[model samples]
Target chain A: MRQSRLVQASLFVFLAAMLTGCGSHVPLEDLTISLILGVDLDEKNNLVISESSPVFNQDAKQNIESYQLKAETVRDSRKYFDALATGEVTAAKIQVLLIGKRVLEHEDWFPVLDTVYRNPTFSLNTRVVVVDGPVSDVMFYVPPDKPQMPLHLKEVIDKNIDRTRAVISTLQVLHRQMYESGMTPSLSVIKKEKDVEFTGVVLLDKKGKYVDTIDAQNSAFLLILRDEKKQELTLTIPMTSLGEGGGIFHKNQISFDVSRVKTDVKTSYNKGKFDFKYQIAMTVNVAERLFPAGRVNQKELEKMIEKELKNRLEDMVKKFQANKIDPIGLGIHARAYQYEQYKKVKPHWDEAFAESNIDVSVDVRIKSMGAVN
Target chain B: MKMAKPTLTLPQYIFLIHGVQMGVGVLTLPRETAEAAGTDGWIGIVLSWVLATAASLIIIQVMKNYPKGTILDLLRHYFGKWIGIAGTILFSLYFGIMATVIFIREALFIQAWILPRTEVYILIALLSIPSYLIVRKNITILGRYSVLVFFMTVWMMIFFIIPLKQAQWLHLLPLLKEGWQPILDSVGTALFSFGGFEIAFFLYPFLQKKEKASMGIVIANTLTLFIYLIITIGAFVFFSPDEITIYNEPSIVMLKILEFRFIERLEIVFFAFYLFVISVTVLPLMYMTVYCTSQLAGEENHRRHLIWLLIIAFVYVVLVPPTFDQNKLLQRLIEQAGMVLAFAFPLCIWAYLLILRNIKRRGN
Candidate 1:
C-alpha cells in the first residue's frame, strides 16, 4: 500500500505539470489591459468601438494608447485590434465605458451594450459615462496634467460620485434603471472642451434615449431629490429674494455647506392624480458670505436660504415634469407607497408622473454660523 | 465491510447535506426564481424548504426500518436480488447524472469568469483530481471537510451587504404581482436547487445519533432556506424587477458592484474562493456515485471504482460542451429526474415497506 501511494503521488505531480501547459493560456505580461472602452455611431451608422490601454512597454513615451475601429459590434473590434497590438486585448480591467452623444441619441443604446452584459470577460462594475460629444474624443484625448487619461477619468468620476456631484451609474446600476419600470436610466456626462470636465448627468427616457442634461450645480439637487446623498454637498445660492443690504457690502450671494440632508417623498393618489410632497430638511454651516458676518441674522438668513432652495427645487421638479422624465425615482416611491394606483400607471409611468402634482418644501436650519459669529 | 463504521456525527450530517444543497444553483437562484415568481421569489424558497424537509424526513423514516445498512442493502434485503439490482442501478444513475451536471456547471462558470482562456476539459480534469483525492477518504473526513469549508466560505455572504447599500427596498413591494400561479410555478425551480438533500438516503444509516438525523436534515434545509432567502431578497432589492432577469447569475453580478480601495473586480476573487464551496457539492456527490456504482458491481470497497468514475465524468464533460442552450436542457433534465428520485422514490419505498410490514403482522 505504501509503495502504491508513492506511485500515485508522482502521477499526480506529473498530471499537474502537464496540465499547466495546456491550450488557451495567456500570460499576464502578454495581455494588453484595456482600461476604458468607448462606443459610438459612425457617419454611415456603423458601430465605432474604441479602447484605451495603459502602455507598459518601457520604450514607449506615452502612458496610454487608444485604438479605434469601426465594426458591427464591440466583440468584433477585438479581432481587429489584436492585429494592430502586440498582445491579447483583455477587457477584464475595463474601468469605464463612455457612450457617445450620437449613440445615446439613438433609440436603443442598450442593445449596443449587450456585449458588456453578456460577455463574461466584461466587468460589470465598469463605470458607464455618457459623453456629451463623440466618445472617441474622450477615449483618445489625453490631458497634459493627468498621468493617464483612463485612470484620471475614472478618478474624476469617482471623486464626483463620492461627493454627490455626479450620479453613480455602474453597468449594474444602469442595467437596473434600464429594466425598472418606475425608473429611467441616467449616466454621468463628461465633455472634453479643454480638459476632461464632468458636465453633470444625462437623463435617459424609458427607451434608453437621452432626454436632457442637468448641469453640475443642479446635479447635487437631483441627487438630493433621489435620496442618494453620500457626502457633504455645498450649494451657493443667489438670494435675490432677500432684501438689499445698506452697507458697502452686497449680501446678494450666500454659500453654505450642507452638513445634513434628509428628503422624504410622500405619495398619495387622489382624484385621478398622483400627489407627491418632497420634504427636504437640511442643516448647514456658513461657508462663505458676501456681506459682513456681524450683520448676518441667523434666523432671517436661514429663512431666506430655505425659501430660495424651495423655489429652486420646485423649478427643478417642474423641469422634470416638462421633460416627462423621473430621474429622481418618484415613480419608485409611487410604486412602493401606492401600489394600487401605481399599477394603473405602470405602463406609462413617465406620462403619469409628468401630469402628477408634485410639491417640494425645504426647511433649512443653520447649525453653525462659523467661528466669527 | 472492513471500513464500515458509523462515524458521521449529527452536526456533520447537517453540514454535509447543507454543503451539497449549496452549489451552482445558489449562484443563479435569484434569476431562476425571479423568472418564475417575479418579486415573490422568496415565497418559492420557503415552499421548497418545507417540501424538501418533508421529503428528507420520509427518507429518514425509510431508513429507520433498517438502521444498520445503506440504501443499497435495504433495497436488496426488501426486494430480493434482481429487483434490488434494478433499484441500485437506478439510484446510481441518478447520482451519476447529478455529479455530471454539477461538474459541467462548475467548469462552465470557471471558464466564463475566472479563466476565460482555460479549456473546459482541462477544468473538468483539474476539478476531478480534488474529487478523487477526497472521495478516496472515509465519510468522517468528508463531513469534517464540509464543516470547515462551510465556515470558511459562509463569511462571503457579508459582501451582499455592500450592494444592499444601493438597494431600493421598494422593489420587493407589491407582493405577488403576477398572482399565485407564478409563485407556484417557481416552487419547482426552487426545489431543483434543493436537490442535494436526497443524499440522505445513503447517509442516514451512517448517522451517529440515528434519531437526530431527521432534525439534522430539517436544520440543514432551514439553513439552506435562510441563505437562499437572504441572497434572493438581496438580489431582488439590488436589481429592479425587470432588471434582475437580465443577469444570468445575480449573486455574482451583485458582487461585481462592490469596489474596494485596493481590490478591483472583486467578483474574480470571490469566484476563485467560491471554488472551495463548490467543491463540497461536487466531491460528496462524486463519492456517492462511485460508492453506489461499486455496490452494484458487487464490490465491498468502492475505492477502486473512484478513479474510473472520475474518468467517465471527465470524458462526459468534454463530450458535452455546455453552451447556454445545452446547459439549460441538462439542468431541466436533472431537475425533473431529481424530483422523481429525490422526492417521489423514497415515498414509494416507504409505502412498500408499510405494506410489507402489515402483511407480515397479519400472517403472524
Candidate 2:
C-alpha cells in the first residue's frame, strides 16, 4: 500500500510539471480564425494576399473584416497580416481559397499553393475556387442577405457541386491532378457581378495556365460528359424545328430535369489517329414543354431531345479539342483502357487529342411528366 | 536461483504478439513497399507473412524442449556459460537499439504532423514517461495492457471507408508488369514491419496453454498480414503509382484527406490516439531488454535495470541528433539486422537442436 501511494504521488508530480511547462503556449482565445484567404497578383506583378476573419467582439458592427498585403511567399505574408490584427493569424479553420484570374494566367501557380499543402498546420480539405476578376473584389464583397462571405461562398460551391453545376475541386484533388500527367486541373469559377455569382468552371492547360471558361448551362453538359454529375440537373434546350414566334421567352424551348446520367468512354487507335466514342444514357423528367400539346408525341419528343442533346455534347467536346485541353480526363480513361496504344502518344496527349475523332451519342428516356399531361 | 514468473493464457498470447508486430512501421509500409515494387506490393506482404510464420514455428520448436525456462536458459544449456552470456548481451543490445528506433521514429512523426513547434527531445522525454510506467509492471499486466490497446485501435480501420470511394481500381491492373524481382525485393523491406513476432521467444516459457501456443502466434501473424494488406492496397488504388512514391507516410496522407462535418485535421487526432498503439511496441521491447539485462547481472529484480535502460534512451536522443534522413537510414539498417536475428538465427538453432536429439537417441 505504501509503494502504490508513492507511485501515485510521483505520477501526480509529473503531470503537474508538464502542465506548467506548457503555460507559455498559444491558446485558442488569442488566435485570429481565418475563414477565407485569397491570392492575386498586383499591377507590378507582386504577390498580393487577402484574408477575411470573423469579428467576434461584441461592439463590432460587421460580422467579418478583410485584410490585404503584398509579400513574396505565403509564410512571409503572415507577418504583415499579424501586425494589423489583434491576434495571431492562423489557417486551421480556413474553408475556401480564392485565386485571381491574373495569377493563374501565369504558369507558376503551383509553387504558390505549395505552402498550403506542405505546411503541416493547414488543412487540405479547403475548397479552392478561381475568380474571374481580382480575388479582393470577391473577398471584400459581402452581400447584406448572406450571413458571412466565407460561409456564403462555401455553401454556394457545395450546393452547386451536388447539383452538377461545378466540379469537386478541393486542395487534395488539385494537388493530385497537378502531379498527374494524364489529367489537367480545373476549378469552379466565381465572378463578382452585381452580387456574388458562380459563373462556371475554368479549365487550365497542362502547364497550369488558364484556358477557357464554360458557363453554368454548358457546365452541366461538361460534367455529364466527364461522368461527374451527382444530383438533379435541369437543362433547357431550344427546339429549332419549331417556329421562332416569341421574342424574349421562346415558345420553342423545352426543359428536362436529369435524374441519372451514365457515360461510357471507349478509345481506339486506328492508323495514326485516336478515336473516342462516348455513350451517354440519361433518365430525365420533363420539367417544362413549350411546344403545342397537339404536336407533342412521346416518342417523337424523346427523339428530338436526344438528337439535340447529342449535338450539344458534340459541340462541347469540339470546344475542348479546339482549346487543346483534356479537362474531362479522357486521357486517364485512355491510359486505363488502352495501355499499349496510349503509351505511344503519351508524350503529347493534347496534340494527339486535338487530332482525334470523338463520337457523342445520347439516349434519353422521360421517366415522369411531373403531374402534367 | 529463481523468481516466481507469471503465465499468460491463449488470448493474451495472441494480443501480445499482434500488438507488438503492428506498430510505427505501419504508418509508412505502403510508401516503402510501393517504392520497392510498383503495384505488386500486396504480393510482398503475403510473402513476408509466410516467412514470419515459418520463423515463429522454428522458435516454437526450440522452446518446446524447455518447459519452464526461456531462451536464456536454453542458450546456457546448449552452449557454454561464456557464449550464453555473450548471446544474452547481444540480444539485449538488439532490443535496446530497436526501442530507440521506434521511439525516435514516432517522435519524428509527432513533430512532422501533430506538433511542429515542440522540440524532438521534449517529445521523447514526454513519451518515455508513460513507457516507464508500463514497463515497470509484471508480464501479466503488460499482456492485459496489450489486449486493451488492441481493442482501442481496431476501430480506426473504419475510417478508411471514406477514402476508399475515390479509389481508382485501374492502378492495380496488369499484375507483374515489372516481373518478380521488385516483389521479392519488397518482401525484404516488408520483413521489418513484421519484426515484433520475435517477442514470442520471451513469452513462450510463460504461456499457460502450451498446447495452443503455436496456433496463437500464427493467428497473430495472419491478423497483421491482413491489416497491412488492407492499408497497402488501399493506398495503392487511391494514389497513382507515381504519386504514391512522393509521400513519406501514405497511410497518414490517406487519413489527412478524410473530412468530417465537425472535425478538421483528423490525422492529428489519429496520431494522438495512436500513441497507445506505439507505446505497446516500446513497452514490451523495453521490458524484454530489462529482463535480459537482469539475467546477465544475476539479479532477479528488474526495476533498477529498467531505469538504466530508460536513462540511456533519454540520453541517446539528446546526444546524437537524428535528422529525418538518418532516422530512415537507421530503420533500413535495423530491418536488415532484424531479418537475420528473427528469421535466420532461429532456423540454425532449431536444426542444431534436432541433430542433437537424434544423436543422443541413436546412442541410447
Candidate 3:
C-alpha cells in the first residue's frame, strides 16, 4: 500500500512539470490568420506589405480590410506589421500573393517567393497575381459595401479562366514553367479602374520580369492558339463565286460573322528540322451570307470557311513569332519528342525558335447551319 | 525438452505469412519499381510474384522431407556440426540486420509524421516493449494476432483509391516506349520486396501438419502478391509519375491529400496502421532470431535467452540515428545480403540434398 502511494505521488509530480512547461508555450487567444498578402516597392525602393482578412459584423454580414506596412525588406516588413498589428505575423496561412508592377520590374521577385516556398506552413497551391500601379493604392481602395474582396479576386480569376481563356496561373504551375527549359511563365494582371474595376494581363519572361501585354482581340487569338477554350469567334473571308470584281465577291473584300471553332495540334521531327501541323476543324452557322444569298452548297461553304480559318491562323502564328513567345508550348513538345537533339540545341533554342519554320493546316467541317438557314 | 503446445490452423498460418511478408518494404515498393520500370512497373511485380512462388515451393518441399527438424537442424544432419553453425550464424545475422532496419525506419516515419517533438530513443523504447512482450507468447497466439492485424491493414487500404479521380492517364501513355531493359531492372529491385518467404524454412518444424503447411505457403504468397499488386497499381494510377518520383512514402502522401468531414488527416490513421503492421512483423522475427540463436548456441532455456537478445536489439535501435536516408542505405545492404542468403543459399542446399539422396539410392 505504501509503495503504490509513492508511485502515484511521483507520477503526479511528473505530470505537473510537463503541464508547467506547456503553459509557458501557450499562444494568445485573439490571433488572426491572414489569408491574402500583397507586396510592392515604394519610391524609396522600400518593401511595402498589405494583408487582407474577412471581417464579420454584428448582423453577420461579411466585410474585409487590407492592412498596410512598409519596411526595408520582407522580414522587416513582417516585424513592422507585428509591432503595429494585434496578432502574430505568419506567412503560412496566406492563400493568395499579389505583387505591384513596380516591384516586379525593379526587384528580384524570386527572393520574396523563395521565403514563402521554403516555409513549411505555406502551401504550394497559393494563387499568385500581379497588380498594376502601386500595391498600396490597390490595397487601400476598399469597397463601401463589401470588405472581403481578396477572396473575390481568386473566384473571379478562376471563373474567368474556366469560362473563357483569360488564363489563371497558380504558384506550382508558375514555378514549373520558370524552371523548365523552353517555357516562360505568365500571370493574369489586374489594375484598379474607376469604380473598383480591373483590366489587362502582363506576360513575364523566364526570370519573372515584365515582358508585354496582349489586348482583347489578340488575347482571344492567344487563347485559341493555346487550345485553352473557344466559345464564339468572328471570321471574315471574300466570296470568290459572285463574279469578277462583283459585289460581295471582290478580292480583298471582307465577309465576316461570329462562328464556332475547334483546333488540334500535332508535332513531328525529321532530320534536323521540327514540324507543327495544326488541324483546325470547325462548323459555322450561317448567320449572314452576303454572296449567292439564295442557298449555298455545303461543300463550297466548307471550303470557303476552311480557307478563311487557315489564313487567320497563319497570321496569328506570325504574330506570335514576331512577339517571340510560344504560349502553345511547341518547344516543350519538341524537347519531349526529341530529347537528345534538344539537349544539344538547348542553349541556342531561343534563336532557333525565332528562325524555325511553321506549317498550318485547317480543315473546317460545317455540321449545321444557323436558325436563319 | 519434449513439451506439447497449441498449434496454429492453416488459415492462421497463412495470415502469419502474409503479415510478415508485407512490412516496411511495401511502403516504398511502388516508387522503387516505378523508378526502375517507368510505367510498366506492375509487370515487374507480377514477374517477381511468379519467381517467389517457385522459390517458396522448393523450400516447402525440402522441409517436408524432415518434418520434425528446421533448416538449422537439417544442415547439422546433412553437413555436420561446423557448417551448420556457420549457416545458422549467417541466418541470425541477416535477421538482426533486418530488425534494425525496420525499427529505424519506423522511428523516422513516426518522428516525421506523428510525433515531431518526441525523442527517438523514447519512441524506439516504447515500440520495442509491446513487440518483446508479444513475442514471449506461444506460437499459436502469435499466429492468431497476426491474422487479426493483417485484416485490419487490408481494410486500411480501401482509403487509398480516393485519389483515382486526379490521376493523369496521359502519364501512362506511350507504353513500352522505353523498351525491355527498364522492366528487367525493375524486377531486380522488386525481388527484395518478396523477402519474407524464407521464413518457411525455419517454421516447418513448428507446424502441426507439415504437408498442409506447404499448401498454406502457396495461399499466403498468392494473397501477398494480390495485396502488393493493388498497392503498386493504385499508387501509380492515383499519382502523376513526376509526383511519385519525389515522395519516398507514396501511400502516406496519397492519404494526406484525402480529407473527410469528420477526419482532417487520414494519414494519422495510416501511421497508426503502419505501427500495427510493424509490430506484427517484428514479433515473429524476434521469436525466430531467439529460437535460431539458442539452437545454434546449445542453450536449454530459449525463452531466457530471448530476454537478452531483446535487450541487445533495444540498445542498438536507440543508439542509431533516426534518419530516412540512413535507413534507406541500411535497407539496401540488407536486401543485397538477403538475396544471397535467402534465395541463392537455398538453391545450393536443395542441390546438395539431391546429390546425397542419389548416392544413398545407388548404394542400396
Candidate 4:
C-alpha cells in the first residue's frame, strides 16, 4: 500500500509539470473572429488592412465592430485589430476578402494576402472580391435593411455563382489561378456607390495585375466557355429587330434557361501559332418568348437563335483576345492537348494566346418551350 | 515458460499489417511523389504495391522453414547463439527507432495543426501512455484494437469527396509528359510508406493459418495501395502542379477547403480522430520493439521493458525534439535502413539456407 501510494504521488507530480506545458483555452465568445478582411493601397502606396468582427455579447450596441489600420502586411495588422477589439482577434472564419482595384493595379499586391495562405486557421474557401474604387467603401458600408455585410456578401456571391452570373474566386481557386501557367485569374468586382453592387468579373493578367472587365451579361458566356455552368444559366438575347409589338414596347428578345452544356476544345499547332476550335453543345428550354406569334417557323427560329448565340460567343472570345487575357481557361485546354507547343510559350501564354486562332461554333438544342402560348 | 500467443484471425492479422503500413507517410506522400515525379505519381503507387507485396512474400517464405519459432528463434537456430543475439539487437533497435519516428511525427502533426502552443514533450508523453498500456497486453488485444480502429477511421475517406468535386482533372493531363524516369524515381519514396509489412517476421507464428500468411499480406498491401492511390489521385486533381509542392502536408491542408454548414474547421476534428488511426501504427511498432528487446535479453515478457522504453521516448522528445526538417531527414534515414532489413536481409538468409540444404541433401 505504501509503495503504490508513493508511485501515485510521483505520477501526480509528473502530470502537474505537464499541466503547465499547454496554453489556456478561451471560450468562443472571447474570440473576436474576423468575418471580413480587406486589403488596399492608400494614396502613398501604403498597405491598409481592415477587419470587421461580429460582437457576440448582447451588451454591445452594434452587431459588428470594424477597424482599419495601415500595416506592412496582413499578418502584422492583427496586432492593431487586437488592440481595438475587446477580445482576441482571429481570422479563422473570414468569409470575404475585398481587394481594392488600385491595389490590383500594382504588380505584386497579391502577396499582401500572404497570411491567408500561410495561416492554417484561415479558411481556403473564403470568397475573394475586388472592390472597384476603395475597398474601404465596400468594407465599411452598412446597409439600413440587410443582414451583416459579411453574410450578405457571401450569400450574394454564392447565389450569383449558382446562377452563372459571376465567377467564384475562392482562396483555393485563386491559389490555383495565380500559379497555373496556362490561365489567368478572374475575380468579380464589387463597388459601393449607394449600395453594394456587383460589377462583373475583373480579368487580371498573368502577374495578377488588372487587365479588363467582363460584364455580367458576358460572364455567363465566359462561364459556359470554361465549362463551369452552374445550376441555372439563363440568357435573354435579342434575336432581331424585325417588328415592334403593337405597343411602345419592342418584343424581340428571347429568354432561355440552359439545362445542360458540354464544351469541347480541340487544339492544333500550325505555321506559327496554335488553333483552338471551341465546340459548344447547349441544351436549353425557352423560358420566355417576346415575339409576335408565328412570325417564323420553329426551325427558322432555332436557326436565328443559333446564329445569334454563335455570334455572341464569338464576340466574347474576341473581347478576351483583345484584352490579351485567357479568363475562360483556353490555355488549360492548350496545355492538356498540346504540351510540347504550350511549353514554349507557357510563361507568356497570354500574349501567345492573343496571337492564336480561336474558332467558336455553338449547337443549341431546344429541350422544351415554356407553358406560354 | 509461457502459454502460446492467442492466434490472430485472418481479418485481425490483415488489419494489423495494413494499419501499420499507412502511418505518417500517407499525409505527405502526395507532395513527395509530386516533387520527385509529376502528377503521374499514381503510377509509382501501383509499382510500389507490387514491389512491397513481393518483398513481404519473401519474408513469409523465409519464416515458413521453421513454422513454430518466431523470427528471433529462427535466427538463433540458423546462426550461432552470438550471431543471433546481435541480429536480435539490431532488429530491436530498428523497430524502437521506428516507434520513435512515428511518435515524433504524430506530435509534429498535432502541434502544427491543433496545439501549436503545447510543448512537444507533453504530446510525446501523452502518446506514450496509450502505447504503454496497449503494448503491455498480448497480441490478441492489439489485433482486435487495430481492426476496431480501422473501421472507426475508414469513414474519414468520405471527406475526400469535397475536393474531388472541384478537381481540375487537367492537372493530371499529358500523362508521362516527363517520361517514366520520374515515376520510377518516386518508387523509392513510395516503397518506404509500404515498410510496415516487414513486421511479418514476428507475426507469422502468431497467425492462425500459417499458409494464409502470403495471401493475407497480399491483401493488406492492396488495401494500403487503395488508400494511397485515392489520396494521391485526389490531391493530384485538386491542386495544380506548381501549388502541390509548396505545403509540406498538402493532403491535410487540402481539407481546409471543405466548408460544411453544420461544422467549421473540420480538419481540427479530423486530426483529433486521426490520432486513433495513427495509433494503429504506433502501438504495433512499440510492441514490436518491446517484444524484440525482451526476447533478445532472455527475459520474461514483463512491464519493466515497456516502462523503460517510454521513459527513453520522453527523454528523446525533450532533449532532441525534431523539427519538421529533422523529421524528414530522420524519416529518410530510417526508411533506408528499413529497406535493407526488410528486403536485402531476408533474400540473403534465404540464399544461405538454400545452399545449406542442397549440401546436406548431397551428403545424405
TM-scores for candidates 1 onward, in order: 0.93, 0.94, 0.73, 0.97
Q: Can you write out model 2's per-residue Cα lDDT over A1-373, one digit (the tens) per residue?
A: 9998997799678767765336657766577889899999998889999999997777878778799889898788899889987778998888999999999899967888778977777887789999999899988887988779999999999999988899888887887777666677889999998998898999999878999999988889888988877766889988876769568878898898998889988777787877889999989998998777678687878898999989888988899899998887787777776667776777778888888889998899989877777
Better of 2 and 3 by TM-score: 2
Candidate 2, clashing residue pairs? none
Top candidate by lDDT: 4
Candidate 1 lDDT over A1-373, as tens digits, reads 9999997899788676757435566677678899999998888778899998977778888867789999888888999889877788988899989888889788876987888888776778888998888888888787876768888888999899888889999887888888888878889999988887899999989999889999988999999999888876889877776568444666677788999999998889998999999899999998887866665588888888888888888998899889998899988888877888888899899999999999998899999878775
Of the pair 3 and 4, which is ahead by DockQ? 4
- Off-target runs (Cα >4 Å) in candidate 2 are A1-15, A25-29, A241-246, A267-275, B1-4, B358-364
Q: Among all windows of ten consecutive residues in candidate 2 chain A, which has the lowest summed lDDT?
A: A18-27
**Chain A in model 1: its TM-score?**
0.93
Error of 2 at A339 (Å): 2.7
Interface RMSD of 2: 2.6
- Selected candidate, larger TM-score, 1 vs 3: 1
lDDT of 4 by residue, A1-373 (tens): 9998998799789877777434587888999989999998899989999989889999988899889899878999988888899899988899999998999898767777777888888899899999999888877788989999999999999999999998989998999889888888999888888899888899998889998887888999899888999889999888763555346665788889999999988889999898999899988899988786588766677788888888999988888888898888878778788888898998899898999999988888888877866
Model 3 lDDT on a 0 to 1 scale: 0.68
TM-score of chain B of each: 0.96, 0.97, 0.94, 0.97
What DockQ class does candidate 4 belong to?
medium
The models' CA-based lDDT, in order, is 0.86, 0.85, 0.68, 0.88
- Backbone clash pairs for candidate 1 read none
Clash pairs, candidate 3, are: A64-A147, A64-A148
